[model samples]
Target: MLKKSPVSRLENLWDDSEAVGMSEPEKLLYRSNLLGSDKRVTNYGGGNTSAKVVERDPLTGDEVEVLWVKGSGGDIGTIRMDGFATLYMDKLEALKGLYRGPEHEDEMVGYLPHCTFNLNTRAASIDTPLHAFVPRRHVDHVHPDAIIAIAASANSKELTQEIFGDEIGWLPWKRPGYELGLWLEKFCRKNPEAKGVVLESHGLFTWADEAKVCYETTLRIINRAIAWFEEKTADTAAFGGEKHPSLPPEERRRIAAALMPAIRGMISEDQHKVGHFDDQNAVLEFVGSHQMEALAALGTSCPDHFLRTKIRPLVVDFDPASPDIADTLDRLRGMVESYRVDYAAYYDRCRHDDSPAMRDPNAVVYLVPGVGMITFAKDKPTARISGEFYVNAINVMRGASAVSEYRGLPEQEAFDIEYWLLEEAKLQRMPAPKSLAGRVAIVTGGAGGIGSATAERYLREGACVVLADIDAEALSATRENLAGRFGPDVVRAVEVNVTSEEAVAAAYADMAVEFGGVDIVVSNAGIASSAPVEDTTLELWNRNMSILSTGYFLVAREAFRMLKAQGIGGSMVFVASKNGLAASPGASAYCTAKASEIHLARCLALEGAPEGIRVNVVNPDAVLRGSRIWQGDWLDQRASTYGTDKEGLEEMYRQRSLLKRSVLPEDIAEACYFFAADTSAKSTGNIINVDAGNVQAFTR
Candidate 1:
């Protein structure tokens, strides 16, 4: 059932005299009003409004000037001619053919030149092609709330026909720009008499031979639908309930600012705004009830609305009987995840083709319990409009559900729409590069195979290195050996135990202040202690854990805080042994500690992703040559136990790998560089194996 609002008097502000003998300023004002009257009617810059006029060109004869189609970032309510990019009719129409023969729509949009004056601003509105295709002198496209409400409803097509049966034609949602333009071209060709087009989950397109006709038609359609919907779901008690108390405007603004960073990459700030559904009696009654989870599964009214309102709302339990809000939040998050999985399955079933789905949910409507609904948006206008639409949709869906289960787009079909080419194109934009460059990296246990080789590779790639070891003599000697070849600043010597957090922190802090900031931190410092699971003493376990696990956390935490505060995205690499992935004979403590570090890195990767910080771990197999762990009696004891000579033991280890080659520290360094450089901008929360393909014993 649809709810319709009472029809008000038709307000036509512009008269024939005012329209026919319009001065430039008067015409601009009229155009602004026609475009800006309805917030839900359009997105920030999603739609374009234009008027045609004859103007003189200096070099060309009898030019048809299109008043600046709204340039990017210019709001319609206050937009002026300066906001519009004036283009010659022929020049604008020629763009239709610019992207020919198997070109991606996004690539076409990207190549479109930024408007002449606002070079630094966003490119022109994406609806330029559709507007240009219309022969009408005045054109407008809007994502009107009323139109979208019907479009999102299950009976949308039927509802639309009932409301505007003779005047309107419906167009299925398609990626904006090229695909949409092509669709409209075919549609208009089929129905030349059609005055307007309704794009499902998108908006409405209305054009008229005259500006007043276009404006009047838009209002009439919306008003008619509103009237019909209100009559269908006219329950006087639908909104009866206690209203949630309001928060201070400043407090609301602060909360919005806090949430902005989390969603910035997905939605622009200008497109986001905070709105309160406090006064909505329906919302209050719904939130006060206990069906929060079911209420949240309903999809957003439109896809673009996700940028304004998140795909679902956050249902905060504010009851005094609730034990913990944090726990409640955890449960809600679990619910969100559950809904996401179900939604994905639904999309997969409905999809006719294969395409990856977006991992992030687009809209979230919160059930604030006693606090009412709080909606998030990329910008304020979007937020307000999205909130209103969501509330309205909720009312309608509930009404329909009272009679029967409310159905949504099939799982696969929804997935198809969500993973559509246009949406994926938005993800293809290149992000900024990592900030750490021209800095040095030092890993302790330098003479040890992994440590020494990592240091060597860093030096070759232009990083000054410091190889620190407990053995002062070995440390000094390695420094002397590498200094002549890689330069003195490229390598330094120090003696320190990684077990001491104070020592590790001081060392990294000094290096940061000395080198402008520790751009990269390789916590590749650890001792391999072998003791059978039963024989592993608590004391031995604690020592190994303190040195390997705790030490890495201390070092990484300091580096991350400094790098993040410095506003630079840093890279941290951890070298956990293969023992971290699978159990090794007589190495319980070592395996546990290494496993802990691996988990730590995974957590850091998630937390650091938004900060442009990337964290990854490289698990390398045993590299016996030059490793302190292999030197002295350690290798001989292991070899004797395995009933093989040291050489044979080393060969066996190399043969165990899928590549049939020994894993080297340099191999690990290559994996480190992938996460550290711009080449892997989209790579995070990944663990790469430098173990020459040890498939059986792999890390998750």
Candidate 2:
């Protein structure tokens, strides 16, 4: 059980019952998971752990020691057994002989693959040598916030000595590689009694022969720092006290919704970007503080934090006392331009001859005073994770600045890590982005078959999808199903009745805050009505118009507003029907409303042409499978129109099609995908008849 404390403290969570009967590698994984479960201990994918386990060699048929460490790009909190890279310990030791020195230590990475034990294909990380060369059998290298606060202080070495004395040692800042590994090996040999070491401007590394001892020692050390900081900071105000009061939660969110799209539009010149807003207490406190700007400008201290957040954040100038969002937005372009110029200058000044060419000059993290922090990246999870890393940095700043002068990594050192050749190689190795990468899409009526299918298609192509529908239960189920497949960060849902103007507008606001902005709009929300012209009551006609025509119009109007605000151009795929192009008996109301939808698309296409917003139509007919409309009176009406019962209606429709095939929701989704994708870039105002070759619905 974790002990309750007045000030939050890292809990020692080792359980003897949980450890019983576990193998050595299993115990290492367990320890890693326990440590990583708390963000205070390590941010996502920010740490690595290892155990040297003796195993039977497949080739030699004899026992040999192997290093099982968290592989490159694996998160210890969620890693599986296979997520570890297994290498022969003797081969790793032999690498000491091949070491050319600190300057050439990068070559050591190339030799690691040669030492893969049991032919494990998991790639070893740069930190691999650090763990492999440690004299202790089990090692935990983590970035607990309290420990990092001490490590990132200007007087880090002194503080380390003052706090723990000889119980823990301290090391000068050195980039993690073969040289650092050798240094660690030397430190352990010189001070075998020390349980751990604080790496200046980096993080903590603790070790012991037993996995349980190593785990306990790591927690004990971090908890000590946490306790020490709590006592020392009891009377001190954090971050030089607050200079700006925080905006109310709802008000801050409203501001973020207005600003994110504008900022996203400017920074997305290279690629489409997704945004994440964090107004958590830590973020609000840091952004509202007097020292926030100075501390943020100094950049992050840890290599992991620096890489994700860039050398520093671009702090937006805004005041809650005299709020003027309009003025701030007007000045945003100039501010962004300045940040880009400064980043480029930094790149130019720090480039080694062998350094990769400059990457995106745009800042990843943006600090908004009195509001909170916003981060944008190639995708949603990255944006969210980047924000989490900055939060860790904030905790470090609060502690270090309160007790000792906070220190950021020197710019030159930051550049070295950011542009390291190995880092560039990792970037090059990434899979090519999918066609819809970074695109955010809203699918109205998203719980229905066609709408859900369209959202799935977009998700498969790497787009973040927002599902909008009035059916709360169905909407939640659809959102959960997609989120499970595509990750929660890339999928969200909002309860919206597109016919309601207020509801439609609010959904757009939610989208802006959740995903930065919108890129594609699938105006698919609709209802079907069938009545002969002589028998069509005013109520029936108006209901059809309300959902089929007015609803599409409402959603498209909101899409136009957001697309224009972002000024990045977007696609609007309106799911009309074949009846729009071909008159159908006994369905006068539905036909007229759909015809109006088609014409509306044409008008919007012409208006949006100059802005590069593309508008198109997909006319699907007789889509019977998994359709909610078909489950209602529309099914009986359609069957009666064809002179058939419900069971034979599908076959009759299939036989009536020129190709003798039935249409499916997935089929309509394909056309929507085309319209939403770049494949339809030059073909605005066009309509595709997906009725299996209907002569009456021919576009020509």
Candidate 3:
């Protein structure tokens, strides 16, 4: 069950009952979770909390003061005890003597590991020194939207003086590091009674000797800001008031669906990127605001916001007043290229000598004046997080601009942090992406044995998959199973019958909106019909053709449309049967439809070759294990035709093959994966027979 906020004033969710008998570090964890719970308090991974505790030193057997702070890249909201880096406060204090001023501060990070308490494996974040240097035993540093609104104001210092009057102090912006830590230490020493300090254009930092007091102090300070903004903006216009009306919700999604794939294609030329589309109220309000272009041009205020979202978003050329999606598509390529060129210029102008080479220049956030926002990134979660961060920035802008002029970080300063040697190292340390990291796949008959297996294979390799199946219940189950393992962000389910043109088209369009565009298409939907040619009714023949042949064509046609639109080469794997090549007795309808599937794939391969779309086939024979088709009358007929009971049918097919091995769904899945992956980059219009060496199914 979702926890309800206890108070209306900015979510005071702390319950005394929940904090009983907790250790200092445990209290710190609890406090951190509370502050990080609401986005209004802090976005994901945006804040840090610390507590100093007395602990017996592993080496000296004497009590020592230790600072436990959230570790690098860890989210406070979901952080565990192991996620904190435990360091000796004495060691951190002793390092002040070694500090060679601001210029040499980057070297301080190298000594952090030396201070590791009890040899904890968690790496200390850059903010560690800031926590250690503070005189208070507990400190809460968070980027609350309400407080950031005050911090990001042009007259921020004056506003700070008016709001909390010295109870909470204000400091000019400084890049967070060893130097800032010392600066904060000096500030605390001078203002002994000050409860907290707001870092200009950054966030709030509150501290108290008691952990509970510290948590409440942070909440109270944020609530004050919220109250101030509410009272002040009650009569004022936000973001210079709305300049453009928001498109209707469905219309907004339709536009987003149309634009995301095109944007994804342009940006994903070098490395594929997954996408996320958000049209939440905050997003729509900001995008439709009069000052959106002006403020967005100034860029985000918070460093975390600026990092997740780029310095600025790409304002898509869309006007809800007179919407034309086609015109927007035509102009999108130039706009994207322009953004790249401008980003390159920014990098070239601000880069230090040791800066890493310019990274992907594509804009992470795209704002449509009418239809909310789109974000594309190396993966789905990152894209979604980028959008979330932008929304936070919008909230900051909304409140800040209503009362005072909002300010962004200076360009050179932003560049310094973006290319900071420490940050660059962190980026470099990230593990290599999986092979299908940013690819999106659509699997027809995705709830079936072979289809589900193939979808899992693609998902394991890091591709976002849309499971399209006619059976809603099975699709939901399959999706839940896959989503449980790969995460909900990477798996989606659509109830679709491949035989319906409209359903197939709608599914592809939905897939486009969900994960940007398609990279892989697996056509595995089928029906197995059994009858001698003389006894085959037209209904039986048409049923087989409708599902096996026509369904494959419909799916491929939609896949081709999207593939060409994305301009990113894709892979299509058709799961045919050995009967496509070698006729089977008493199953002429199924065999003929299977042949049509194979031939349809060949034709598509020929047509799609120039577009770099590789069409391939994976054929299997007597794959009775977990096959939905094999559970019906077709199985009985096949068994009767072979003069064997159902129990012995598989043994007959295994012995009949050149290799006496029974085929399973996983065997076919492996073949589909090969064709869908880069391993088969140079091959197309090819068929792999997974029928345990069926000589008759072999290619001529």
RMSD each, Å = 18.2, 1.7, 1.6
Best by TM-score: 2
TM-score between model 1 and native:
0.48
Q: Which candidate should be chosen as best, given lDDT against the real structure?
A: 2
Write the residue-wise lDDT of candidate 1 on 1-700 in tens digits: 1123333433444567657887543574576655565443444444567666566665555554644466655666667656775555666666666767434665666654632222324456566667666766777776665667666656666666777885788876565676677777677778778878887656688877666777777777766765665676565333233233334444433333222222222222122212233336556566555444464555554555444444456555445233344455445445545645754565556554546554444334555554456554422334445566566555544443432234333334445556766556555654532232244465767766677777776666656566766777777777787887876544666676776766765565444322323446677877777656787799989988997898888878876765564444657788887778877777788889999999999999999888878888888777676667777656775676567998898788888778889866677767766666557777776788777778756754
Per-candidate TM-score against the hidden true structure: 0.48, 0.98, 0.97
- lDDT, model 3, position 676: 84
* Deviation from native of the Cα of residue 510 in model 2, angstroms: 0.5
lDDT of each: 0.61, 0.93, 0.91
Clashing pairs in 2: none
Better by lDDT, candidate 3 or 2 = 2
Per-residue CA lDDT of candidate 2, range 126-173, in tens?
Answer: 999999988889999999889899999999999999899998999999
Candidate 1's C-alpha runs over 4 A off are 1-29, 40-46, 65-67, 95-103, 114-122, 235-279, 285-295, 317-364, 376-700
Q: What is the TM-score ranking, best to worst? A: 2, 3, 1
- Superposed Cα deviation of residue 86, candidate 3 (Å): 1.0
